[model samples]
Target: MPYHIDLFAVFILLGVVQAIFLSFFFLSRENRKNDVNFFQGLMLLSMAACILEIFLMYTGYIVDCLFLVDFSEPFALAIGPSFYLMIRSLIHGSVSRKMQLVHYIFPVVYFFLLIPFLIQSNDFKYNSWVYAYHPNLPFRDVSVGYDPRWLWVTDHHTLMSLVSIGIYFLFGLVEVIRAFKEKRESFFAPVHSVLKKLRSGILHMTSATVIIFVVKYLNIDDTGDHLFAAYISFTIYLTSFNVISHSGFFRQVALSEPQKYKSSGVTADAQKELLDKLAMLMTRDKPFLQSGFSLPELAGKLNTTVHVLSQVINDGLGKSFFEMVAEYRVEEAKRLLKEQPHVKVEEIAEQVGYNSKSSFNTAFKKISGKTPSEFRSA
Candidate 1:
């Protein structure tokens, strides 16, 4: 068989490369600890695999490697579940192991069902591919020892895939909706911009996939798969562009500011020491409990310059000085709310160093996802 290549094939090949790269990028050890990254990595890998198979078949490359034909069918089933799980992880921090198992069962079963066809002779698989994708091509005569009942499943795979993806898309949409409702946030809300983008991206990608599948199947059955593959490539490119743009890597850096604390003179050792001192101060003295406690006063207590203290809190702890104080205050407030249930919310707020109840309510809700009254009542 002769090889075929075109601009469409090239586009798809590039998308496959990028999708695989991003899959590994997200799955890398540095990012694996994050549940969202882990599931997104899995989703990307599944998408890359499905697109790669489509690319090869669409470009006639599979003619040279018939044994690899249809290898990505099972992975196609995984795309929906992985995407759903990614959304779940984003909203809930992590998906339960049992839920993961349940979601993956369909893909696992499909893989098992595909094994028979996968092990068939090259001629058998080639004829199968030709029947589905290239009906004009001459079919080679081949004999199979037994009937592969799984062909029934493969016969309706397009519809099955569409339904599978649609079901999971609904699941993911519901999950996002529930999360937003519970958090009192909306997709249009200015807060949680990162999460909003993520949710919106997932929905758009999944919905686009569904539409592409429907159009492809309706217009040209399996032969129009390249169109679907092309869309997947476009989705991958869009995802990559979004990731880079949102990463802030290209944000303008002010020449005058240079680094955040280039002149602070705080060495790594001193930063760690300051962080330790800050932690000890919070634990031992609970200075955040003092109403109107100021950063300068905390710096004075730590015997460090305000700039150095700010750097310590921001760099070493990954939060601003005020954010760290707020966290401490909220934690103390929670303890008081739980242990001293009879205490009024105002008294608890005052005890946690907030001069006003409204300010305390805001901080408590921001950190704990609930107001003091709601938390106490729960």
Candidate 2:
């Protein structure tokens, strides 16, 4: 077989570039705010590394430099965990260190499994790459360079990759569904849109992984490589599409911003007082009516730390910052719609801090069981 860069190879290379740029863009300070962005960056970076391995293999670089091949296997193993963490953080705010360690067990195990292959002599690796897998290739005599044991290693990697991604994909789907339900009940317009985009991306990525895993599991020997190439290319393309479309992933605030309150030692009574003050501030000042309002700004106005305010909003009030803001904005929109019947929907949306009328409508409908128009007409 002649080794050449095909269209799939081009796509794989493009995917690598796109993923790396997105990863770096998300990891940079401008994009880094919350665990969601951090994990999204990790996912994109992992994807770039994995796809780069594929690109190298198809381009025959892996044959020239066998050491580079081992990294791909572990990187491929990392996709499931990275993807899971990204979605989990998007839905759940932040993940615990223990959970992160638990999710990485598969990648760690795969890294150890590749130890034997990694320690092999360069000549041994090059020979194995040329003759161990590819059949009927020129300048490589299969009988002289082939290692029978390598087939088992490759097969194990494939099997484990399938199982890991399948499990995590299902787990991710559950989380997405749970988040959808919560968002519906909570009326968080800003984050609801974010959740919808996140769910769509997760579903697409998960479907691609599932299709590839199922095809590989079926073990169609003749077309397996071709199928793998096509599916992997599709997966990369889908991921690139998602990253481009769901730009909200890059806008999240960091999880560690609330770290200052970890040892603040505020008692229950003090938290209650803060909550009352927060209520008074929201009721009297109507700060949520301000466009681009933030938890830090709210905390500052209340003469409190962001950590304590965040804790009060999340734990004491059982609402996220966005949810609380949406609640107030929706109520304000209701009053305006009721009193100012002649006002335009867009103007009303602008007045209530929703930059988008659709967002305002979504929040209104979610909270009042009617769109702004319907509410006004009633």
Candidate 3:
């Protein structure tokens, strides 16, 4: 109640608002019900709650209302695991339920450890807030003489969080590096682009964590300028949201469905029949020539599930749906380039199922190793 709203408080308050908005925004997406969305939303919610508590403390509201002091730990403990889980989901595509439970163990244990403080009497809480945690008290003195229980909960929580996040960041870095090293050249360029963004995201998060750790280690966190941490956190969330929004996660396409493939046994004979039918469909019917053609539509025409078709494309044909489509479109574009040398590249692109000239150029270059105009000339 005694604190005034300064510039630092205003910025951190804005970060808190943004984090909260992003959390619900991701959570509300019906199509994105997977580890990626769930973990990212959980991470945002955790960060929002922690930042809100910091904002409250910075505004001196925590001092006025003693109960808030006991609420921050649960959210704080959740940050490390949520962050790790989010990255894991992005890299691995999905996380097992057992692994999810394993990540949550620390936060759950820490939550129960705070039970004693949560049940404290109002008078005791008030006295503790006034005498032990008064804003006027020096930061150094606040933890030095406190009840070990309080010290253990607060100090250990901060230390454990740094360690946990740091360890996960290192693990995520290894996963990103491995992903790059193991990447196949034949993957769809669009999917490859998304993977590159994911790699950058992993590095960005690791760098942010390092900065936060450095600030904490240098005791910059003690200067009451919690704005530094809030700004860094906001940057991370903003970058993550942009990447996720554009990465096709929000689409109806199944990115993280656990049961992507069903157990319908397609025998060797069935597979060859399906392959022949697929060849006829592509060569004769030319479904890929249609604008906005999708896997579901093609699967329906073939009288098969999307999963079965996807497996046939990925395992049987050794190509993704995007790759297959792009290959056909680019080959058609090349034929047009040879036949109608006077036609514009954009016109050819539209004729060959590409909506944008840029996309056509990218796909053409990726497939043929030359731009559309270059292909035309050569």
> What C-alpha lDDT do the candidate models reach, one value each?
0.80, 0.71, 0.70
Taking all chains together, the TM-score of candidate 2 against the true structure is 0.58
Residue-level lDDT tens digits of model 2 in 282-360: 8878989888899988876665568778887887888899998999999998899888889999999999898998888
Best by lDDT: 1
Estimate candidate 3's alpha-carbon lDDT, on a 0 to 1 scale.
0.70
Runs in model 1 with CA error above 4 Å? 149-151, 248-378
In candidate 3, the residue pairs with backbone N, CA or C atoms under 3 Å apart (3 or more residues apart, or in different chains) clash, namely: none
Q: How far in Å is the alpha carbon of 206 misplaced in model 3?
A: 2.5
TM-scores, one per candidate: 0.70, 0.58, 0.58
Model 3 TM-score relative to the real fold = 0.58
Query: lDDT by residue for model 1 over 232-262, one digit each (tens)?
Result: 8888898898767555345555668758753
Q: Which stretches in model 2 have alpha-carbon errors above 4 Å?
A: 137-155, 184-191, 218-378
lDDT of 3 by residue, 1-378 (tens): 368688778778878778877778678754245567788788778877877777776676775676776476777677777777777766555688899899888788877777766766555555545443364653322222335356465546667777777887777677666666656532224235436556666756767777767767776334433745566556745655674655433344343544533343444444555565677578767788887999998886665668777877776788999899999988888999999999999899899888899999999999999999998888
The weakest ten consecutive residues by lDDT in model 2 span 140-149
* Models sorted by lDDT, best on top: 1, 2, 3
